[model samples]
Target: MIIMPQLSPIDVLKRSNAAWLIRDQWRNILEDAYELVFAGINPYTQDKKAPRSMNRQFDSTATASTVRLANRILNEMTPPFDNWADIKAGALLEMTMDKEQIAALDQQLSGVSKLVNILVNSPTAVSARSAAILDTLISGMGVILGIENPEDDVVPITDQAVSQSEVAIEVNARGEIGGIYRKRKIKVREIKDIWPDAVIPSDLLAKLNEKKDPEIEVLEVTYEGGPGSNVAWYYEVLMCAKGQDPHRMVERTYDVSPWTVFRWMVIPGMPYGPGPVLLGLADIRTANKVVEMILQQAAIAMAGMYLVRDDGVLNPDNIRIAAGGMIPVQYTGGNGGASMVPLGTNREFDLGQLILDQLRTAIKKHLYDGTLPPETGSPRSATEWIQRIKDLNQDLGVGIGMMMADVVQYVRRRVEVLIKRGMVPKISVDQLTTKVEINSPLARAQKLSKVQDVINWLQMANAAAPNAVATVANLEKIVAWISSMMGVPPELLYSEEEKKKIQQNIAAITAAQAQQANAPAPSQAS
Candidate 1:
């Protein structure tokens, strides 16, 4: 119930612009991430007064690693049409629903999940997500603003990628991003189209009447609802004309925030998190500089240098270092002007090459794009394999866990939007009624290690004492849980009642067989 301070449009606008200034403190670091890792992305502050160039990368190692890792995250976390997630009943609601009802719910939710996946995998979404993930890798965080397409019934969601440079975020006390303020230049003519209710200033309208489509700055903000508000966030579009106070163009609220700020790694109490680029920025910069130096060295080596003694024998201006070129020089000491001695130029780059190799390796390590060398020792044992999986899980678990949170939010928010637009059936979706299950490749891998641990424990219990495993674990429920986690279809599983009926029938048959066998022996003796 935290209440936002009441502020006039001018104050809000000034605050939004001030956030940009506050964020500029990280300009150097963010600029390095942009210049070294992704030259195409906007830096923290750009020189609007001058033309810009991109892709000035001297060393491609970090750039290559960044692109590869982004692709890896996309394919593994939100692979297209992979059925990587599901919507199901939450713990509180599961006990209330019967098996048939739960099954029906699953069927309904599956269709909704499918539609959501469609929206997420759309061309616009993929492109936006790809850019966002790349920026997250390079600049620590990325954002995408979801916009609905009212025309298309099948895939009604389109995404617009927001550059980190233009966006400033604030986190709530819960360590979640509660507000986003973004500023960008927009053309005068497009204001009516973008914000139909905008009240254009007299001076700007006067300029527009003169057919001058001047571009002006506009600030867009989405923030948490104040006390006693119902919606998740309030949205407003503001503008500050030249020499005038800022004013609001559009004001509205949303059930879920359209703009999402996703970070690679969070630092508590900080709105923005650090990315892999920050970890390897030093190596990236040093490696690029080293490679630049190597190129310079090579150029110098190719353009041979020589010293001509003050004897004026060899004319320095007449020397041609190219193929088979000769320069006439006065003879001295009976040695055809051997006085023109070539200066010592050592072309061996062993040291530079070694440094570059190590730098590249470090870059890949930081980006999680490195390869392990061949195994020269004994083969890995079962215990070692289990440990290996567990280690990987521990290493990647935090980031992947955070990603899962975003993915769930993304799905739920998009689904809610769909429901609001009548693209989906009318159904109440709240945290208490349903839950999201992530089955993406990396998420499942994280779960796989835990599943293995449970199985290993069960095996140890069985080895220690017969029937002791049953006391420690519900073997049947474990099977069902494992199957669900492993992507097994629910229809293939047996219900508890069906299992009990089968067990009873088996017991009856066994008793009859025992009675028949015992009676047969007595009859044969008679």
Candidate 2:
């Protein structure tokens, strides 16, 4: 038996294209042929005795006639080609051969006939071929018409595919790119990696089980960065819920960008069920409007928290205003004509305490009165309240001088103890006197007798023994003893050369006193 070779896929594809073209030609020919066959004059005249009826039967007859004519034309237009080989050869030649050349056409006629037969013999093959050809032709026509083929409208499909493909491609590219791009690197840096230091650790849920009312809530928030690049970290306290995600209460992180961190914190009824909450946000100078909004929200929330009723209004009696003024006092004593004595201890203390109490009362009154300014009355306003407090503080400073006098007295007692303990030397007495004269105005204003009395006290305390040894060794011992008592290093009292001169002066003074005491006895014998 002779073996029949299987057709290649390319051969099948070509045949499909040819069949599709043939079918299209048939369709066009049939349409034209049917139009011609259906042509007819109206049978009923306008003057017909009975009114002419446009019935469904007449429409059916016309359609049947048209179909029959279409069949005949299609059959004639698409006659069977001979075989697969002939059809294939004809198609190839048709693509390249000039249709205007009679010689080439004559040469290919036999092959063309065989191809037509093959197409006609296999209906299934013919149908598949026709479908493929129709698809291609339709697609081409669509491009020309600027309208895509309904079955193969692949523009949107291709675009979608491309987008998905691009996403994949970018991901892969990023992996292969090694170091991050500068833009991405900067963004990553800006997003600080606080993952290691996150306030809410992974194990927080377990620890949260041990608390009552363990609902986690954020409290204070702060932000850092420049005007446009700020970021925030939120501080929160979590309470245990009766039955919730976490049991033990603790702290958690609420990292956010600076732009709305404050809003997040101060938002009423936020982390917990809606109610008044205190939230401290960063003082953002650039975000003035946002800051104002936050302040208003906070004020409203505070008002709500302290509200006496549900009417969303603060109580008028809650408002208070405290005010005060200062008066400097001078006293005339029996001995002195007049002296500035800022109403000493008793009066100063009493006045200060009274002023502070009054201020507190004013605050209480303002809060109770609910007289906030702009919204309420002048006295209740924050501005007015602040000014009132400021004035009170200023007045309180008047008595501060008397308070300082008590501090000075304590310091003087400590100094006197140090002097008696020989922690300060006698030669330094002149220096000490000068210091007292310069610093103690009260001492300077004392009677001359009182000043002399103080000097006498000093002289008795600091007096040295008569006829004391004045040799270099004795002087050195004295200087060293004084230096030790004063907590000053001996070397600092006198350099090696200066020590010699100090010793000589002490020896001369001692010798002069001895000679005078010895010589005065001989003169008294006469």
Candidate 3:
């Protein structure tokens, strides 16, 4: 019994008109930018006669750099937690039912988290025909849609299930993404497949069924909400191929809850997805062509140095362009002069190299503007390496912070959806505030510094009082704190009872050894 407001014909047309107006404005620019990234085409130089070799070379660098940065984020950051709900609720705050409940729930949540991670990393997680959504995410803004990927109907249900996100869909925009509209096509069959029970007019369904090739279309549009709303409205509008007026098929007033759509932006605060490689693409393409031109000029200068006498034949083709080749140039009637003249100079080549370097620097500079660090120089020691990582953290801090929020939100929404879909069993989560901790090399180094401070304090305390460290009643607590700071798994740690048992066994063994040492003369007396 899901109830939704039915839009009148005029109202539907109005909404559809608004959505298209927004789309019509932004589609070209966004599409062009996206094509530049995914297709490796410099739209400015995408003419049919453009050199394929040059395009490939430029694309390789751009794609490689983008992928490298994306991989760095994936590898360095702490993996998203599946038990974020429990962690968020401060489940360990109490020593009674709270702790027990949280502990029990963690066991279940751990398995769920692992399964989710598997699906995220697996090929099935990405959209069909997409090599990776992350590639587009880093290079440009990319969208990932969570749609039901139904399998065979007769399979037994299990927790080890695939993710629902079918593809990393790309959205096209016009100008700046801010106030503009965004739209993508959804096939009629795709809609039916994902939402079989969705409400639709009976006549439309019958018409669709009767047509051999139904050309029904649904436009999923996201646009700025009405005046003063400060939010984007998402809508699915029925767009028949015939001249029928567009009508709302489904509508959401704000951010799609539980996130059926996840948007990843390379740059924050801007609706338009700006990318690193894209910014310097024009320069890179031009530089590539310039280098080719320079080489061609140099070849002409060297090969064109032929001994041509004034009395020789003037047919240039008859003269084989090779080493030790004789050329029959036009014959001069009077005094014949043979001299060597180079068409191009080595000085120009020197200038060309400088120009090439500058172009490369431009490309590197764009990539290094927070997304990645430029290869300035190599660190000499482990300490230097740590310092370098810290520098990178500082450089990328703001961008990572923005990206972290979106990423965490995406994962959180996916987890919730998984639970609702019964792929993960629902666990009782209290008032927990879970946070995504980045365990990147830089972040880890910072954590280690904090842990070292704790160690330094403990050492001073032990020096002040002998056995002070060992005498602490809550030494295990300190150890646990340090272990957590170091990102050690909670399951790897020993419980308080287990620690007590271990201490008791050690004490008993020590006492038995001492007793035996003291009683050595007893056997001799007997």
Score residue 205 of candidate 2 by CA lDDT.
42
Span of 10 residues, lowest total lDDT, candidate 3: 156-165
Superposed model 2: Cα runs more than 4 Å off: 1-492, 505-526
TM-score (all chains, Cα) for each model: 0.81, 0.13, 0.63
Q: Give candidate 3 misplaced runs (Cα > 4 Å).
A: 1-60, 78-104, 126-140, 150-182, 185-191, 198-216, 221-237, 240-242, 248-270, 278-289, 292-347, 369-392, 427-449, 452-475, 506-526
Index of the highest-lDDT prediction: 1
Query: How far does residue 170 in candidate 2 sit from its true spot (Å)?
Result: 51
Residue-by-residue lDDT tens digits, candidate 1, 66-169: 89878878877877657776777676678898866886687677777777777887788888888888878887878899876556676677788888888988
Ranking by lDDT: 1, 3, 2
Q: With candidate 2 superimposed using the best TM-score fit, by how many Å does residue 347's alpha carbon deviate from the native?
A: 30
Number of the top candidate by TM-score?
1
Q: What's the number of clashes in each of the models?
A: 0, 44, 20
Give per-residue CA lDDT, model 3, range 1-526, as digits (tens).
Answer: 3333444545544555554553345445444443444344332333524633333242344455555555555544433222221122243433334644655545545666655554444443433113223433334434444443335322211212111111222223532222212233445667666455446677776767687655565544434343344343433434444566655565544332223232333434333343455556676566666667776666666655455553434555666654434454454234555433332233357877788777767765555533434547774665555566666566555555555454554455445545555777764332343333334464677777777777778888888886766877377678877786766665797755677899999999999999999885745654
